[model samples]
Target chain A: MVTVLFFAAAKEAAGMELLRLEVSQSLSLLQLQQRVLQLVPALQPLQSLLLWAVNNQYAVPAQVIESGDTVACFPPVSGG
Target chain B: MIQLTDQPLDYAAITESVRDPAAGAVVLFLGTVREFTAGQQTEQLEYEAYREMALASLQQLVQEAASMYPLVKVAVVHRLGVLQLTDVAVAIAVSTPHRAQAFAAGQWLIDTLKQRVPIWKREHYVDGRVQWQHPSQEAAVAPVVGEAS
Candidate 1:
């Protein structure tokens, strides 16, 4: 299983903070994002804007994502 | 000390924590929720973060700053949940051998944190409107429905 986490504006869009999906094999971040966007339609419009991370570290779209990894998605940060 | 707290920030305590006998200067920075922004009156502010990542990011930023500068010690605190106007949203404290270094490090930490950290802020306007802040946006607002609290 891969845990997908959302925060701030992305969380609002997803309607929940996190979800765990059963993944049979490893996938790229882009593939994972596509699968997530399909399940959470409210996040469709934010596809290009959401930032991605894996296992609590910032990640790129083409980065490899494995089962048991925690992936995070969020909008641009504005903290001080 | 790096922390993400839902409770109020004790800036003085944070500043005190970084005080060192070997360091000649200590700098404290408090990011407060202001009442106005470009003539728009903000009633309150709500802050949230990807907790684990946010904390890890803070630790990395501190290590990076320490390497770039001769930092003696550093402490950072960020508040989550709803905050009223004038509330302390974030606090950063740094100690260095000189005031200049302390000032420079403090500023860089805040600027970098604003851009890189996973924490987010939502502004509650006096007109009963609210929006999520994306610093890169040009007056754009992200509308929120359910309360995340």
Candidate 2:
């Protein structure tokens, strides 16, 4: 299971912090993004602009997630 | 000290930290809470952050600024919790040997911190509605140009 975390506007919009999902390691970041969009349809329009991080490191679209990795997706930060 | 504070900020203490004889120029940037957004009247703002993560990122940013310019010092403090209108929400100070580098480095620190740090703010409206300020999609991704320790 991988943990998905949210923050800021995404957290307020989703009304939650973390979610646990059981998925295979074959899932690429791109595919995982699509899965998130499926779960939170409101984020569909934001998919392209969202930034992702796996286990606290910035992630690229092609990166694959380990089963226990914590994945975070949120809008571009604005935290001066 | 570079920090993300949960209490009221002390501007004098922050300003004093930039004093250095080697620095002929010092620049300070303060971001304040405004009472209006778009057309609506704002009541207050609540800021939150992933504390440890935010602090780590801010420290990295300060180290990078120090190396990029001939800067003697760089500090950033962002306040969390409830903030009234006109309250100072964030402040950044950079000191360098020249005016140009100090100004540029100070601006870069504020702009880049907004883009890369993990802090968030929620605006409370007069009507009891609340909204989180989302990041603008149009902001330029100011490149991370220096080595961070």
TM-score of each: 0.93, 0.83
* Segments of candidate 2 deviating more than 4 angstroms: A23-26, A40-42, A45-49, B135-149
User: What DockQ do the predictions score, one after another?
Assistant: 0.46, 0.43
True contacts kept of each: 0.63, 0.48
- Per-residue alpha-carbon lDDT of candidate 1 for residues B6-110, written as tens digits (9 for 90 to 100): 999988899999999979999999999999999999999999888888898889889889989899999999999999988999999999999999999999999
lDDT score, candidate 1, position B82: 97
Per-residue C-alpha lDDT of model 2 across residues A1-80, encoded as one tens digit per residue? 98889877676666778778898556897788778778887776666666676665566779887688888877766564
I-RMSD for candidate 1: 8.8
Off by over 4 Å in 1: B138-149
CAPRI grade of model 2? acceptable
* Best-matching candidate per lDDT: 1
DockQ of 1: 0.46
- In terms of lDDT, the poorest run of 10 residues in model 1 chain B is B140-149
- Residues A13-63, model 1: lDDT tens digits: 899999899999888999999999999999998776787888877776788
User: Who wins the TM-score comparison?
Assistant: 1
Write one digit per residue (lDDT tens) for candidate 2, span B86-113. Answer: 8999999888989999999988889878
